[model samples]
Target chain A: MFHLIKKDLIIQKHLLLLYLIMLTIFIYFQNSSVFIIVLISAIMTLNSFYYDDFFNAHKLMNALPFTRKELVSAKFIGIIVFTSATMIVFMIVSSILNGGIVLLAWQWIVFSLALAMFYGALYIPLIYKLANQNLISIFLFIYVVTAILIPSILDYINEYFPNIILFFYHLPDSQLYSLLLLISVIFYLLSWRLSIKIYEEKEL
Target chain B: MSNILEVDGLRKVYAKSQFVLKDIDFSIPYGSIVGFIGENGAGKTTTMGAILGTLKKDRGAITIFGKKVDVTKPKIREDIGVVFDDMNFSSHLNVDQLAKVMKNIYQQWDNDKYNHYIQLFSLPKKQKIAGFSRGMSMKLSIAVALSHGAKLLILDEATAGLDPVARDDILEVFIDFVKDKDHAIFLSSHITSDIEKIADELIFIKNGEIILKVNKDELLHNYAIVQCRSDTFHEINEDDVLAYITKDEMLNVLVSNKHGLPRGCQISDFTIDDITLLLMKGENNERTHS
Candidate 1:
C-alpha cells in the first residue's frame, strides 16, 4: 500500500521544478493560500491519474499482486499524502518569499486537507466507475452547469438562506474546521469503499 | 502430470455480447510451457484475466499451486507473473524507476535478476520506456515478468511485436524459466512458431473453444496435412480427419494419424502454421461441411 501511494510521486517527479515555481508565484501573489493549496493538492493527485490512464497503468496495477481494495485505499490515502506534502512545500515557499519562517499557516493546511478529501471523495469513485473519457464529460457538464447557475443560485441563497449563510460564516474557525474535517473524513472513507467495490468488478 | 496451474470448465461472457468461453479447460504442468494459440477475440485475454482474477469468471474453477484460493489474493498472486500486451508501467517513469515500482509491488522481486535481464535485453536503464520500440517494450515486460520469482508466468502476446531475433531471445528466457521443474508458463499468442519454438504443449482455441491440445512433439511428428481428391476424401475414414479445406480439385485434409492415411496419400512437409491455419479455417470432422 505504501508503494502504491509512492507511485504517484515517482511518476510526477518530473513536474517538481514547475510545481516549485508555481508555488512561489502562488505564495507571492495569492492572498487565499488555502484555495491554492487545495487546488495544488487536487492537481497533484489528478496528474498521477492522467499518467496512469495515458499508459493504461491501471490495468497493470490491477494485474499486480495488490488487491482492488488496496488500490482504492492507496488512492484515498495518497490524497492525504499529497495534501500534506503540498502544505509543507507551500509553507516553505511562503517563508522563503517572506524572508522568514513566520508563514507557517497551519489553518491553511487543515482547510486544504478538508477540501482535498472532499474533492477526492467526489472524484475517485467517478474515476473508478466512469473512467477517463466519461469522467471528463461529467466534469465538463458540472463546470458548465456551475458556470451558468452561480449567479441565480447566489441570488436564491441570499434571498432565502441568509440566516444559514450567516450562521456558517460566523462559526468559529476551530469549530468550522472540525465540522468540515469530520464531514470530509466520513465522505472520503465512504468513497474509498465505493471505489473499491467498483474497481473489484471492473473488467481491467 | 503435476500441473502448476489448472482451469476446468472456465467460462466468461462479456456483457451484451454473444461471445463466450465454452467450457475451456487446460493445464500448464510444472517444467513445461503451454502455448495458447487463438485468433483475436477468441477469449485468450479473457481466459488469462480469469486466471489472474482481473476479470471475474461467469463460471469455473481456477486452481493454482494445487490450491483453490482466490487468485487476487496477494499470497496467491505472489506466485504468479503476468504480462498483458496493452498493460504497461507508467511511461513517465524510466526503466530504473520502474524497477523501484516493481520491487515494491512484488514481494519476491529480485533486483539483481531484473538488472541482469535489463542488461541481457540491452534495454537502457536511464531512458524512459516510452522511448522504447515495440520490441524493447516487450523485452522489458518479459524481463519484469521473469525477475519476479513467480512459479507460473501468464503472458498475453508477449512476443507479438518483436523481431525474430528479439522473439528468440525472449523465448530463451521463457525456456530458462521452466528449467527448475517447479515453474511453468502459460502464454497466449497467435504466433504459432513462437509456441512451436518453446512450448512443450500446445492448446489451440478458436471462437472461445479449445479445439485441440497435444504434445508439441506429437503435433510436429504425427499431425499431417495431406492433399486428397474428392473421391479419396470420401474414402478417408471420418474419424481420421481433424479438419479439411477444399481448394479447386484437391482437398487439404488435416489428419492426426498420418500412418494409416488413404493408400496413395502421403504426409506433406508442414509446419504448425499450416496446422493452425487449417484448424482455424477448415470445418471439424464430425460432419464435413464447408
Candidate 2:
C-alpha cells in the first residue's frame, strides 16, 4: 500500500511541485488563506486520481498482489498525507511571514482540513465509478456549475426561510465543528466501502 | 508431472453483447510452454483476464499451483507474473523507479535479476518509459515479470510488436525460464511461428471456445494436410477429418490421423500457421458423440 502511494507521488512529481509553488504564491500574496489552502489541497487530491485515470494505473495495480480494499485505503491515506504535508508547509511559511501562528491561521487550518475531507468523501467514489475520461469531464462540469450556483441558492433560502438560517446561526461553534467532523468521517468511510465494492465488480 | 495452472468450465458473457466464453478449459504442466493461439476477439484476452482475476468469471474454477485462486487474498498473485499487450505501467516512471515500486509489491523481488534483465535488454535506467519504443516497452515489461520469483508467467501477445530478432531474444528468455522444471509459461499470440519454435503444447481457440488442444510433437508428427479431388475427399472417413476447405476444385483437408488417408491422396507438409488457417477457415466434421 505504501508502494502504491509512493507510485502516485512519483508519477505526479512535477504537478506536485507546481502545486507547491502555487500555494506559496497564494500564501505570500493573497489574503484569502483559508480558501486557497483548501482549494490547493482539494486540487492535489483530485490530481492524483486524475493521473490514475489517465494512465490506467489502477488496472495495473489490480493485477499486483494487492486487494481492492488495500487500494482504496491507499488513496484515502494518500489524501491525508498530502493534506497534512501541505498544511505543515503552509503553517511554517505563514508563521515566518507573520510573527507566529495567528488565531486566524488555526481557523483556516481546521476549515481546510474539513473541506479536504468533504471533497475526498464525495469524489473518491465518483472516480472509481466514472473512471472514463468523458464521464469525468461531465462530472467536473456539473460540480463547477453547482459550486457557482450554490451561494446564490443559499442566499435565496436565507431570504425566504429565515427560520432555517436562525437555526444554523444559533448552533454552538464547538457543536458545528464536531458535527462536521463526524459527518465527514462517516461519509468518507462509506465512500471507501462503496469504492471497494465497485472496484471488485469492475472488469479491468 | 503436475500441472501448474488448470482452468475448468470457465464461462463469461458480455452484458451489452452476444459474445460468450463457452466452457473454456486448458492447463499448463510444469516446465512446459503452452501456446494459446487464436484470432482477434477469440476470447484469448478474456480467458487470461479471468485467470488473473482481473475479470470476474461467471462459473468455473481456476487452480494455480494446485490451489483455488482467490482474488481478494492476492497472496497467490505473488507467484504469478503477467504482461498484457499494451503497456500497463505509468509513463512518468523510469525503469529504476518501477523497480522500487515492484520491490515493495512483490515479496521475493530480486534486484540483481532485474538489473541483469535491464542490462541484457539494453534498457536505459533513467529514461522514462513513456518515450520507449514498442519493443523496448515489451522488453521492460518482461524484465519486470522475470525479476520477481514468479513460478508461472502468463504473457498475452508478449511478442506482438517486436521485430524478429527481438522476438527471438525474448523467446530464448522464455525457454530459459522453464528450465528448472518448476516454472511454466502460458503464452498467447497470433504469431504461430513463435509458438512452433518454443511451445510444448498448443491450444487453439475460436469464438470463445477451445477448438483444439494437443501436444506440439503430436501435432507435428500425427497431423497431416491432405490435398485431393472432390471424389477422393468424399471417400475419406469423417472421423479423420478435423477441418477442410475447397479451393478451385481441389480439396485441402486437415486430418488428425495421417495413416487414415485414402490411397492416391497427396500428403503435404504443413506448419502451425497452415494448421491454424485451415482450422479457422475450414469446416469441422460434426462429432457423432458429445
Candidate 3:
C-alpha cells in the first residue's frame, strides 16, 4: 500500500510543486486561508486519480499483488498524508510571516484540517463509485447548487435556527476541536468502507 | 509434465454485446511457452483478463500454482507477471523513477536485472516513457515483467510493435526466463513465426472459442496441408479434416493426420503461419462439409 502511495506521489510531483507555490501565495495574502488550504489539499489528493485514469494505471494496479481493498485504503491514506503535510507547512509559514504562532493561525489550521478531512470523506467514495469522468460532473453539479443555495440557506438558519448557530459559535475551542475530530474520523472510516465495497465490484 | 497454470471451462459475456467466451480451456506446463493464437475480437484478451482475475468470469476455474486463484489475495499475484499490448505505466514517470516505484511494489524486484534489461533494450534511462516509441514502451513493460521473480508470465501481444531484431531479442529473453524448471510463459501474438520459434504448445482461438490446442511438435509432425481437387477433397473423411479453403478450382485442406491420404492428394510442408491463415480465414471442415 505504501508503494502505491509512493507511485501516486511520484507521478504528481510536478503538481505538488505547483501547489506549494499556490500555498505560499495563499499564506502570504492571508485571505481565505482555510478555503485555499482545502482547495489545495483536494487537488493534490485527487491528482493521483487523474494520473491513474490518464495512464490507465488502474488496470496495472488491479493486476498487481494488491487487493481492491488495499488500493482504496492507500488512496485514503495518501489523502491524509498529503493534507497533514500541507497543513503543517501552512502553519509554519503563517507563524513565520506573523513573527510567532497566534490564535488566528491555530484556528485556521484546525479549520483547514477539519475541512480537508470532510473533503476526503466526501470525495473518495464518490471517486470509487463514479470514477473519473462522472465524479467531475457530479462535483460541478454540486458546486452550482451550493453556490445558488448558500445565501438563502444562511438566511433561513439565521431566522429560525439562531439558537443552534449561537450554540456552535459559543462552543469552547477544545469542545469544537473534539467534535470535528470525532466527525472526521467517523466519516473517513465510513467512506473507506464504502470505497472498498464499490471498488471490489468495479470492472477495470 | 507439471502444469503451472490451468484454465478450465472459462466463460464471459460483456453487457449489451453478443460476444462471449464459451468454455475456454487450456494449460501452460512448467518450463514451456504456450502460444495463444487468435484473430481480432476472438476473446484472447478476454481470456487472459479472466485468468488474471481482472475480468469477472461468468463461469470457470483458474488454477495457478496448483491452487484455485483468489485474486483478492495479494500473495497469489506475487508469483505472476503480466504485460499487455497497451502500456499501463504513467507517462510522467521516467525509467529510473518507474524502477523505484516497482521496487517498492514487488517484493522480489531485481534492480540489477531491470538495469540489465534497460541496457539490453537500449532504452533511455532519463527520458519520460511518454516520449518512448511503441517498441520502447513494449520493451520497458517486458523488462518490468521479467525483473520481478514471477514464476509465470502472461503476455498479450508483447511483441506487437517491435522490429524483427528487437522482437528476436525479447523472444530470447522469454526463452531464457523459462529455462528454469519452475518457470513458464503464456503469450499471445499475431506473429506466428515468433510462436513457431519458441512455443512448445499452441492454442488457436476463433470467435471466442478454442478450436485447437496441440503440442507444437505434434502439430508440426501430425498435421498436413493437402492440395487436391474438390472431388478428391470430398472423398476424404471429414473427421480427419480440420479446415479448408477453396480457390481456383483447387481445395487446400488442413488435415490432422496425413497417413493413408487418398492417391494423388498432394501433401505439402506447412508453417505456423500457413496453419494460422487457414484456421482464421478458411471454413471449418464440419461447417463446409455439412
Candidate 1, residues A75-187, lDDT tens digits: the string is 88888998888788887887777788855566666777887898889888998787774564465356446545757997799789898778878999898888889998999
1 versus 3: better TM-score goes to? 1
Off by over 4 Å in 1: A103-106, A133-160, B285-290
Candidate 3 lDDT over B1-290, as tens digits, reads 49999999999988778898998888888999999998989999999988887788999999999999887776778789999997568888899999989998999999999999999999999999989999999999999998988999999999999999999999999999999879999999999999999999999888888888888988888788999998899888778788999989998999887886887689988899998888888897333110
Clashing pairs in 2: none
* Candidates sorted on DockQ, descending: 3, 1, 2
Off by over 4 Å in 2: A96-107, A134-158, A162-166, B285-290
Ranking by lDDT: 3, 2, 1
Worst 10 residues of 3 chain B by lDDT: B281-290
Kindly report, for each predicted structure in the order presented, the TM-score of its chain A compared with the true chain A.
0.86, 0.83, 0.84
Total backbone collisions, model 3: 0
Q: Write the per-residue lDDT of candidate 2 for residues A1-204, one digit (tens) a residue.
A: 888778677777767778778777877895466555656666666767777777766666777899888988888877777777777777777777777883444545566677667777787787788786565556455555666676898999899998987886899877776777778788878888888888778888
Quality class of the docking in candidate 2, CAPRI style? medium
Per-candidate clashes, comma-separated: 0, 0, 0
Q: Relative to the unseen true structure, what is the C-alpha lDDT of residue A13 in candidate 1, on a scale of 0 to 100?
A: 84
